[model samples]
Target: MSQNNDNSVLFGNGDELPSNASDNPHINQLIDGVGRRQVLAAGAALGTLAFLGSVMPGAAVAAEPAAKGLEKLHFRPRSKLPFTAIATNRLDSISVPTGYRATPFIPWGTPITGNYPAYLSDGSNSAQDQAEQLGMHHDGMHFFPIDAQRGGKKSDHGLLVLNHEYIDAPLLHPNGPTLVAGKRSSAEEVRKEINAHGVSVVEVRRGLNGEWAVLPSARNRRITGATPMQISGPARGHALLKTRYSPKGTATRGTLNNCSHGFTPWGTYLTCEENWAGYFASRDTDLPRELSRYGLRSSSRYGWDHLKGDEFERFDATRTTTTASADYRNEPNHFGWIVEIDPFAPESVPVKRTALGRFAHEGLVFAPVKSGRPVVCYSGDDSQNEYIYKYVSRDKYRPGRSNGRLLDEGTLYVARFDASGKGEWLALDIYDKKFQQACKAAGVSFADQGEVLINTRLAADVVGATKMDRPEWGAVNPDNGEVYFTLTNNSARTSVDAANPRPANAFGHIIRWRELCKDYAGRQFAWSLFMLAGPEADSIGPNGKPLTADNRLASPDGLWFDEEGRLWIQTDMSGSQLSSGPFGNNQMLVAEPRTGELKRFLVGPVGAEVTGITATPDFRTLFVNIQHPGEGSTATNLLSTWPDGPGQRPRSATVIITREDGRRLL
Candidate 1:
């Protein structure tokens, strides 16, 4: 059943009290505050009521100027500030602000070294060529400073680790691959596709007067689908991960569908894997007994199985044979986790830390870690009706400069929201008797923690975690320590319980939570509906106060906070939706969370999904990506003529946004 078709039940009235009030006196105090305010007010006031205005907490009070065009953020800004839209159809390019300039920092198939030539884009790029060159479909990225000791200053150079989600076959191959009965071209072609499916690490530096470019330094590296990466935590070496590449089952070769990303406190890069299941193609007739165990009931979408003689056949997870020991039953277990890369240490191997649990991981955000307390990381599964998760390190963090060893050991928990406005983090541990009983009762087989992490969806389902709309990127409010996450609309999610109840969620909403005692690792927390995304008229709170337009956004995907604690939100919508005129196109927004002061900061051309937002420490310069502009168009039919080229197909490119007057983005 599609997620939208599910039943909708009001979770509870928004004014309900805490579910466990007896044990928590804070609830009583909050309840009293609500009662006292009601007695004083007597009735709901409509126009510009200060009491309704204060409901959003830290929202800014000052009205923001409408976006006539790009303007400065009014704070200390970066000089040489300029903004430009990169032009492209086939080959992607970078766009910069007016005075500022941008060049090709890196491009697909640009060789790192060895005998590989630059990419021909005609399917001639080899596995070795792919290993040395940048991967296809560059998405979420971060610029890690070479020297953090410099403190909040832009580095002349740094390491850039970018994700290559998936390859567009028509663009990669000259005449398209030779498909035979819904299979791929050749073994060589299949190999090239595999090698192009991971993270690309390149050293980049700003030249004299702040021109950013890639440097062919020794630290440049590429981790592909065949690159050896260790699997850590409970799910390592389980029966599911054993592939022909690693029969011992201790490691997997690479990561795929890397969408959004995060940065660890110790300076490592975190790449998330999303929508990976579509790449493989298996036959329905070959269904194995273990097929349902790994969510592969349908044929593979990519047609990789048609390759005459290639290991791509392993994409078929359905067991044609009765026994799990035959063929490649364990191949599906390698993906859907947060992979960490140490950009500072080029020689370091990427590790899949399984303690974070597994699903369609979108991004990971670290909560502020106190010296004597456990560190916490928040993550979201990007599929409709999926769950939000947190991983708290079992060991406490030490203040002095330490590598990210704390991340290697942690307990993963999924959220369960109660009707009374409080929530609990349900632990997912194979060692726990409760977990074992739950797993058995659900008729799923799990032998250890490794198995639990491998099948986290099953475990979460058994535990009754709150299923949400498509949960996308998240950002923590630096000023107030509240966790804010975007629930992108779920076309399939129509069921409304307490948390998610709307059908055809045209635009979605942002949900926020504050931990008790301000502890990031706390298992229990308090939460509230931050803001609903739609027209301003639709955002009425329970108290009959109108929510500000800044708090009303649709399909929020990428979210980040600048150095000065300003929140940036980016949107993504399909082509048909854009053409209808209800919305212009995907755009970027800036908001002061405390006051619900939000405004459209920038808008992209047609057919683009605005994504991948990050800012320099000074908040003067911002980088955003325009993905798949004119995305639904084919060679035979075209819609948008963006980045302006001669009969060129639109290509996704990164844009640098800066103020014309040289002011910060706050």
Candidate 2:
């Protein structure tokens, strides 16, 4: 997600605190360190600073000479994009290339499970009705094939798992939230909103006409904000997680603010919790580091605590009672962790894997698995001036034998990029000498591993981890094991570094790295800038030239790599900037990683962010999400009435794109 009015204030440590020298390394220093060799190898490597003029140690080097403009770089085969690059537009509907067909499907409030309740056009559906229907504001998603033994590529019939990031209260209701004397009055309204957050799993089948439809199956399920979930890993029984609902601290109720998502090798879905701190309110003057560093406000975002009952009162995380389990002070602690769900098994309870470390997780992407190697994955903290993290399992991955437990016993490391185009992954372990010394020097202490994982941000701060500009979604290249991540714009960034080069970076950039010695769990890595996203005049392309009309973009948010190794980039430009920004509306673009060439694939409707992308195993069908269309408008003054045309409310939806002829989507 991009920084906006609703979430920007909740992001901690933007410009409020000065950047320490250790946390902000100079970009010039890194550039100067490699300037001499880079100039000499300009012809060998693609003559662009975007590649840093260096290839990975074991990567295949291109022998052919480089070309100019949109021409192929000879680093990879010249496979042309199937469709023509679409032009930028501010249309109130989805726009695609000439030969592609984009169909809106599975929109918000679509019923697929349980009793299959029908959707009411007037937004008068009951809370129970919403519990059985699709949730609002779709984000990250994945498709699981029904036939598991078909090499996991049975795309004709599959189960779709998606995350409901947050709710638009004004659109969720007929006349907006009801409040009496500045307090939420209708408990049903609040319940409906709660049911609108979390994950949704439903079976879908492709018909003879090439359209997808939701099917009625027992595996279809909805995990909402009020559902029961288990807290697993080292922090499961910690004192900080003890709440009134779960006195043993082994469980928590639901997941909120689920933004981006991931999938495990053993076929499970991972939904990340982002911007959840603002959902809770604490009235206490003296706040702990967990709450203070996360920027919890005095009032909740949706005023859920204004009502009665334990479910509603838990939103107010103030220490009203003495005992830990007497009040809901620890309610806020239960969130901000990755929640894993089995979309194939509807009856299985979701588990919050805490060993990955607690913070505002954007998403996680696993490295290519080897039989004898440990499971390694990367995640980013989606907040201003935060740090990126990596998790390495203690046990080796045994293919079918490995499960979520592989994530339970592992080390969580924060990244520190240096000025020499090199980076280090500092472990947040209580036993590491570097961590111990840094914590003592910074006057910080932790009781055990649980505390260390719970206070991950503080631990990274003590170890002097590099401050990043709002790291969001991450993807790993299939051709090479290099990891790439999107550093969304940070307007409040007062410090500049090699990784985060621009101060007050409004147009974000993409960064990639290859682990040293080809070991993902290794501490060291080589880093480089992929591309700087912005207007044509302000942005730099992959070939070290100004970006053209086909490739210029801003605030790159969601990122993914397909089976064929093409990188898919999605944007989440804020509503306030859409009018004045050169980029028309939020869009999705395809990039040739080796060549640094990009082309606009699709453009979304007004006030919507193009995010949460996936593709069928055969690459013939592609699924993309359009979130919050016509956002920032009130009920009285509707800004967008898309998908349903002139008289209906704008709905966040998933779009299916296919080729005009029955062929692969590439």
Candidate 3:
């Protein structure tokens, strides 16, 4: 589910066996300060840290309260979630609670714009046609309600924008991918795959019969790998991003492997780029330091570079000529940033906002906004032993006045888990004294702020940020703005810390924290584990049992909080959990934050990962994505027959869940 969501991000690398990620000795390179910090956090880190940490996100540090910080947190409780718990099953169909019904909507190949050709579903759609339709492997999404007009907050009808993270080639084409001698056979196949990797925004409206349907509207648009993007923030004009196509180093084409998402206070879609490095190939006898750290290799994960033509050549970053624009060597640098797209202004070029400090970003969540206060966003670099990050905007956020401008300038910080239950946000800024000293010792000097951003992972290391166990999706509680993240397991960890209590953590746990007294942007915060996920049988010891009425889910990936203050978690079972574990299939569950009561809400079909959740503003209609059904299937030996009968193609789809009586969900 969320396991293979993105190739694990690495400050250093070692992966579960059979994975293509290369092992690197960089793990030993971590500054003693950070490693010792993690071990300390593991032991004493239990409740809110009893020290100075963060300043309020909106308030100045000097204005911080003199009293207890996070201990002062008092979140209001909401009503318990509705619906009976669903049991995990190996069945080949979407299962919902007893009173609910599910229906597929705007799945891959569905046309969102009027001029796009209707999906033939027979794999006959051309590259251009697929470009105009929804991309493949639906992931994280959000429903922006059109309140009668663009900035309006109308709940019943709105634009449903979702991410297509990856594609299922065999099902996308007539039979399977065309190959000649193990290389691509047609340029169109490569183009179609490219078109299938991006974001889609489509209008949906409730009919007179009270059913939701895709409505052709001007706002409906598709942003595929072909969409041109503008690079902004500190890393905009860096040499690492310079290419012949955008010599100024400010623009590039398309986005790749958009896994999770976020919504800004200004009404724009924040599409996160995960695992973009795998798309390019570099045959260099030696690799660029940053490129190598991100996992760019001599061969691509999918051999798109092997296709024959200049159109397909961009997929290969290997330097072919001596000149600057001759190849795509700098192409990979343009990716891996948090891309901002204005769904309302469909024609606007999406921007890759660099202030966020990119990594294999899984998902992003913003803290509650206040006028005259700086905005704060939390993101997880979904990789094994990578770090969690945050960005504090330079300017105060004005509700209606701020759209995308608030993202242009900010300070990026990596988290350090203090063993005492408290944590610190280590500034990765080039000017940070300790970080500067670390870089100096390594014989490096900051050429500019851009250099710090281009090599964000290295900067985090120099500053000593704590390594985590594959941090996935994160959420800011609506009830109190408490930040919560899913550390989705790390079997590669030969050692364990208090933050990661389990040895070779196969099943992950949910960690949450309170920003100092009302200071959502404050550097210091108090944190605690909300739930430790594992099979019910393994819920023994001080690790405590899975939450009462446990779901026993693994790799918690996608997470969202409904208007009712209910937190919904989506599970991702990678490798063995797909079949060998008691977690029968990927699932989605509902949790009561105040009580830690979790219930299994729905389970996906065989080989399908249940992800990308969003409910309409009214909370009556809920949407969930079924990704890679029959995934890892071969042309001759398929793994599943889901959403379709036996022998038919299994397409990843978005399905809507609603109560039979049309009452509110949760």
Candidate 4:
């Protein structure tokens, strides 16, 4: 069964409400700070596919005179996709094109630096052993090119950094989480699960035999839930962030639910915290609106809190202490930010740059930087009817090893897409009178700028940002710099609108926007749907004929654009598609940005998602992650064991897909 994103069910009373802007607040601020009306005006929604006629054009960006051909930047003609499309299938193993070969590499439990025991078929690895092994549920990733001269040339020898989204306890341990008479039975077991919830930086090399292998290097390290991270940017040093361990609010321990990733132009890796709120439990009856909005008040996603000891107890975010710095009540505040790590410098500590603004960050992809231009990164809040965001740096970018200065001192903007094919980037700044008035009207309590950054969702709501389906991974077209994001299926979508026309959006769609005048930091953007994911029988081109086999995909999740302008899209399916269906297994396909021609490049094994893709700058070698085969399986009944035969535990892994003839992909 493909996973359904339904947030209409109430979180309490067994029927949960997805934290949406359900209430209206009267604010005496300008629309987009234009000093017009204080009453929030609802942006019109795209009511039908007719809005797509001007899909790629920035029809609403105020007409500014431009250089010759600058007007055509947003009107680039679509090109033909160059790969042969593979038929969808329900095969238990991976499938690829005729000329391509897939080799599984660096699977979960592959020891990096420890004298750890080999993984046993019976799932009996000790918690201490798992600390040194690769974590589970690999998601978004990036390949940092190892330039010997450090001049940024593409190299096959580089660090392969990946986000271990979460752990599947049932598949990892002998039995599911050990419960003793309704409470967590073993503290050691809980420790092991915590150890498996962060990011991994592995050294990958292309051997003489034309294969990629996990090589041991000084940088080969695992950052588990127990690792300490520094808190930097606007939200740092705030009183609300104070906890027993980091009383100053300048530090925290570990990164959780790391989903997608970004590679900084200054040579650092960004592992995003997506869906991280569920890990901690909040017990405060009079919880702050931000905490309640994030849904941490619900029962812990995992019962890590039930275990004895502060090490585990800190995960319970309830304000049990009369004063700050006595417990982990603020633990949830430290997470859900874009965590920055220097993969090249193994000794350096990871930093959570709070200027990015916290929410459920999907992937953070930066627009290509030019000299003296403020660096910009685009991201999406991954929840039903949430919002998309972008962080524009205060300082222009400098090319060199990461000094850790760019992400700090930045303004975060929430997108408000207009139904008439235009969008405005609403700045989430207190200096903006509208933002201040909305905060006052919404009753959001924040002592300072740091508090506002910590509680970004509240700020977004106050700004009246556009609601969207589950926005997943994002990609920026290197050719035209158009920002693209995947709106993964939202089963709760009960009404049709311009952006999401399908009432029940089971088949996800991709949307793109051209920033006005091709400026990466432009506030005005022209937006439109790029393509809708669905079955071949229903798929069609603009001409209304059946789309090619390449376009017959559902639920776009992982996305990337090769250096040569080829867009590589990966699929994620849940519920029914896991076993048998039109889109049998999750897959990765290559497509043309303009022509919208799509062709299936590869399909994952049964019961797994195709995610975490990157490639050599030359595009000769493409790396992809096949995550959670036998994903929802149980200890007693295994559905489909993969990356190993049946009777062996299924393991998530990174696979290297290369052309067999030792040439760049044709």
Choose 1 or 4, whichever is better by TM-score: 4
Tell me which of candidates 1 and 4 scores higher on lDDT: 4
Error of 4 at 160 (Å): 0.6
Q: Which ten residues in a row have the lowest lDDT in candidate 3?
A: 10-19
Q: Which residue runs of candidate 4 sit more than 4 Å off their true CA positions?
A: 1-17, 23-80, 440-445, 537-550
Which is the better candidate, 1 or 3, if ranked by TM-score?
A: 3
Q: How well does candidate 1 match the true structure, expressed as C-alpha RMSD?
A: 9.0
Off by over 4 Å in 2: 6-78
C-alpha local distance difference test of each model: 0.61, 0.81, 0.73, 0.74
RMSD to native for every prediction? 9.0, 4.4, 5.5, 5.8
Query: How big is the RMSD of model 2?
Result: 4.4
Best by lDDT: 2
1-666, model 3: which lDDT tens digit per residue? 344533332111112122213222222132222332222222121222111122222222211222245333344555666567887788888889988989887777888885778887568889899988888889889888876235655767888999988776776777767877767777888899889999999889987666888887898999988789999988888877888688878888999889899989888899998877777778888977677767776666567888776567777887777864667788888878889988888889999999898688888899877799899899988777788899999899986688677787888988877655567888878777777787787676678778888888777766667777788899876655667898877766666554665557788777776676454677887665566677766542112333333467887777888765678888878679878867888889887654445688988888887888887767788889989887776555668766656876677889989888888765
- Give the lDDT ranking, best first: 2, 4, 3, 1
Model 3 residue 300 lDDT score: 65
| Residue range 233-333, candidate 4, lDDT tens digits | 98888887899998888998999888898988777889999887777777677777657777775457667887778788888887777877998888888
lDDT-wise, the better of 2 and 4 is: 2
Q: How well is each residue in 286-357 modelled by candidate 1, as lDDT tens digits?
A: 543223433453545446655543256566654456544454566667777789888767789899887787
CA deviation > 4 Å runs, candidate 1: 1-128, 149-152, 281-294, 308-311, 318-326, 399-405, 433-445, 536-553, 633-644, 661-663
lDDT of 3: 0.73
* Native-referenced Cα lDDT, model 1: 0.61
